[model samples]
Target: MGYAQLVIGPAGSGKSTYCSSLYQHCETVGRTIHMVNLDPAAEHFSYPVSTDIRELISLDDVMEELGMGPNGGLIYCMEHLEDNLDDWLDEQLDGYLDDDYLVFDCPGQIELFTHVPVLRNFVEHLKRKNFNVCAVYFLDSQFVSDVTKYISGCMASLSAMIQLELPHINILSKMDLVSNKKDVEEYLNPEAQVLLSQLNRQMAPKFGKLNKSLAELAAHVFQMSMLSLLFPAKSMA
Candidate 1:
């Protein structure tokens, strides 16, 4: 069976950078990994894409011709990709061997992975093609320094899990850039109570009860999702 990694992250979270670095490292080791660009709006790329969604439809063309805003245009482009999966994506997959490893560098739009049907449909198409797919999520390490922002990241990751329900790997990217490594490293072995206490201190007393509930919920979800516990640091497999 074929294997795939859907590289996903917020804008400026280093998805493209990760893909480039991974491709280069693989090349150095004399290993071949196919990189597929799924971001129709992506104007530049660091890795050579084996198959680019832009070739089928581009955000620029959609925006200029349809007079849609950037966000709307991006959504349109992705939906168009979903619509053409059988024809274009299928043909592209046919070019690869059954055991080939593909890394899909996807768009940075959070909505696409959270609530949108586009990526859900896209993953379904891959499964139908006999590929075992795993979502590789990149979360900026800076967010971990602040509890509120860290919780926001968790919520976004949880939303993605709910939407796609794929085997996933959560990565705190750009660790090299984090000036306060200790604060970021703490999450590697997360203590829910400590996190909740920290979160409550950051917010007003009026939200204390609500914060507790959210904490319990986060703990429960993290355990059940098993995403956080599964990997401290991982390479795509």
Candidate 2:
């Protein structure tokens, strides 16, 4: 049973940086962790990849030859990867032993995680291969400072959680760069009562009744017992 982290986030949200830092952290603690570059459009990276998806298909090659834009080309490249999972991905993963720790540095495409079945199918393939995979969803720490943005981030995380049906871990990345950590840290493990108060303050007076309902809903959703809690209910087994 191999352990794997599917590092994912919106573009420029530090998925790659998180992977690099995590890799370094593992090294400092005398642990072995292999990183696989799953971003075909990635031009640079801090960590060396054990296996690269670009070898099978690249956005540059797809775009230059097929005349697709950057986004479309990357989607095409990922779709191509999905098609070759049994062949190319299998060949690359064959070298790693069971119980190996792998970090897949995936593309920063939001659509891939939100609604697309490509990544979902890819994860299913990993499970079939006996990998205990965790989806580490990173959000820029700056975005969570405000109540509205925090809610949006939470919803996005929730969407991914429901879509993939995996053990999800939501990470507020780039914490070191946050100057006003106090404001942001408050939202990390926010209480339902606090969220309700914040929502009431942010909404208009005309929406007082609506805000109350929204607050109750938000509170219910954020409760520890909620089925769709953004935070994973239990430790990964």
Candidate 3:
């Protein structure tokens, strides 16, 4: 069976960079990992794309032909991908051996991973083709500095975990940019009570109930008992 990492995250969360790093990492370890460019709108790429969806459909072509904006054209491109899965994606993936590992560098669209069924359905296709798939969701480390933002990140990750129904790994990216390492150290395997306290100190007391709920959700999400995985990267210093 094929092993695959479905890399996804919000825009500027380093999804492509992660793929590039992982690719280089695999090369250093003498491992073979192919990258698939799933984003039709992707104009430039850092990693060598082993297979590309643009071979089948392209966002620029869609936008120019349909007069659709970026958002609309991207959605159209994704829907077109879904429709062509049986024919196009299957054909592309079939070229690889069963044991080949593939990293799918998806579009940095949060909604595509959190709520959209397009990717969910795509994963199902991979499973049918005997792929052992894992979803690696990335969030910006800078965005998680504040308590409220951290809680929101947790919820967003939890939503993707439940929605994808695949092995999930959450990564906090851009650790290299965080100057204050102390601020980040406190969040590693953070305690629910401590998180609530931090939020209380950051926001108005009137938001206490909201903070409590968010904290509880984050606790449940981060709890060792949960299947959800958390990965925090240190600055590459």
Q: How far off is model 3, as Cα RMSD?
A: 2.7
Question: Residues 1-237, candidate 3, lDDT per residue (tens digit)?
Answer: 999999988888888887887887888889988999999989898779999989988999999999999888888899899999999888888899989999999998777888889999999999999999998888888887777777778888888888899887787787778888677657667777898999999999999998888887787776643323334343221
Which segments of candidate 1 are over 4 A away from where they belong? 220-237
Cα lDDT for residue 112, candidate 1: 97
Off by over 4 Å in 2: 204-237
- Measured on C-alpha atoms, candidate 3 has an lDDT of 0.83
Q: What root-mean-square deviation over C-alphas does model 1 reach? A: 3.2
Error of 1 at 222 (Å): 5.4
Number of backbone collisions per candidate, in order?
Answer: 0, 0, 0
Residue 181, candidate 1: Cα error in Å is: 1.5
Query: What is the clash tally of candidate 1?
Result: 0
Instruction: Provide the lowest-lDDT 10-residue window in model 1.
Output: 228-237
For model 2, what is the alpha-carbon lDDT of residue 153?
76
In candidate 2, what are the lDDT values of residues 105-127, reduced to their tens digit? 98988889989888999999999
